[model samples]
Target chain A: GGIITQTPKFLIGQEGQKLTLKCQQNFNHDTMYWYRQDSGKGLRLIYYSITENDLQKGDLSEGYDASREKKSSFSLTVTSAQKNEMAVFLCASSIPQGTGNTLYFGEGSRLIVV
Target chain B: GDSVTQTEGLVTVTEGLPVKLNCTYQTTYLTIAFFWYVQYLNEAPQVLLKSSTDNKRTEHQGFHATLHKSSSSFHLQKSSAQLSDSALYYCALSEPSGSWQLIFGSGTQLTVMP
Candidate 1:
């Protein structure tokens, strides 16, 4: 059994400030993903990495950057925080299976932009 | 483009009564898998059930859902609801050829009362 850990469970940032969320997974999975969760909007994929040093743009990738420097770590950076924005960001890892993969997620990091 | 849709934003049910959460999807890929994920209060979303084969029912934790490819639906159902079942549920679609990315629906929140 392994776990995914997200740093800084709560982040408070000022508008136009740059903020970053970090994720670490010990599952040794081949894939890692970052998703933004908003009330009534569901979960939107921001970025994902199929392997170390690889990145894929998701539907909501604009204004966000991701890094996969190592297989166990993935990081997301918000270029400019939006004013009064509040959202929870989730990190997940998964191993590919037949036609699908079951994801394991971290508790999540909540971001508040003032 | 691939997308999942969960019609209900909120559902309230009495304990011991039947409950259902609707989920539908649209994808260009012929071979895909569907997933139902449950998230309790302040917890990460976890896989509740998954299936790929058309018309085959998948069950877990007393909940069941059958994949109906013809209708492009995979609705979650339970014969008896419990207070413990109150949570946010999300339906997701995974396309094997689409880099195994899981596209999620705009989740449904179920509140089971005593």
Candidate 2:
């Protein structure tokens, strides 16, 4: 079995500051995704990478940037933080991307913007 | 735009009782697929079950959900509730024939009390 690791299990950032989050997986999956989960809200996709250096914007990609530095790593950057923002950012990987599919996720990185 | 709707935000149940969480989705695609994901405290959301076939029941970890294409719904259910079942549940949808990006609904917090 493989595991997905997200760096800095918790993050505290200042408003208007830039925050970066990193994820790495040992499963060698082809698709990697970053999602944001606000309190009481559904998980929203921020960005996704089909392969190394490939990037696709999701519905909630505004104010965020993502990168697939390599096949095993995906990174997200919060362009500007919100003073009261509090959410969990999840990193997931799939062998391939499509329906009739399952995803594996990292433990997640909790962010608290001050 | 693709979207998912979860009717309730919280569902509390007593142990040994039946459980159900309503989920519905809307999309402008021909072939649709649905998913139910569960998230435990401080953990990443995990896929519980998935279905795309109309009226077909999908089951896992004692939970079941059926995709009703005509109604644009895929509600989660279980025969009996247990303490371990307590968690936040999310509903998501994707169009099989189009992009495989998942659109998720606002999650429901389920507390199965003993």
Candidate 3:
């Protein structure tokens, strides 16, 4: 059994300020991902890392940056926070399945921009 | 671009009632796989079921979903609903040949009332 831990469960940031969210997984999975969750919009992938130091962009990676400095940790930075923006950020890790992978997610970090 | 669509935003059912959540998807690749993920309140999402074989029903924890390749659909269903079943459900698509990414749809929130 392993766990994914996301720091700062609640985040409050000022408009235009840069905000960072961190994640750590003990599963020793090779793939890590960051996703943004908004009300009624489900989850949107922002960035993913296949292994240490590897990065890939997803549909909503425009205002975000991610880094996989170590295999156990992945970090996401909001380049510029938008006014009145509120969303939950989720971090996940997975082991490759036959053709697809099953993801294990963190509790999530909520970002509130004022 | 590959995408998934979950038609229902919210589904409320009484205890012991049948439950169903509709999901549809589109992809250009020849091989396609689908997954159903469940998210409980304030918790991370977890894979509930997955299938790639057409018309073969996959079940887990009393939940079942069948992937219909011809219709580009993989709808989640359960014979009986329970209070513990209340959660947010997401449908996702993956085409390993195209990309090792999982595309998700807007989630359906199911509230199984007692």
- List TM-scores for all candidates, in order: 0.98, 0.95, 0.97
TM-score of 2: 0.95
True-vs-predicted CA distance for residue A18, candidate 2, Å: 1.5
- On a 0 to 100 scale, what is the lDDT of residue B59 in model 1? 93
Note the DockQ of each predicted structure. 0.86, 0.67, 0.76
lDDT of 1 at A95: 95
TM-score for chain A as predicted in candidate 1: 0.97
* lDDT comparison, 1 vs 3, better candidate: 1
What lDDT tens digits, residue by residue, belong to model 3 across residues A5-95? 9998999999999999999999999999999998888889899999999999988899999999999999999999996458999999998
**Residue range B33-90, candidate 1, lDDT tens digits:** 8999999999989999999899988999999999999999999999999999999999
Query: What order do candidates take by DockQ, descending?
Result: 1, 3, 2
Q: State which candidate, 1 or 2, has the greater lDDT.
A: 1
The order of the candidates by lDDT, greatest first, is: 1, 3, 2
**Against the true structure, what is model 3's DockQ?**
0.76
Write down the TM-score for model 3. 0.97
Clashes of 3: 0
Q: Who is ahead in lDDT, 2 or 3?
A: 3
lDDT by residue for model 2 (A10-114), tens: 999999999999999999888899998886778888998888999999878999999898999999999998865578899998764445556788989989887
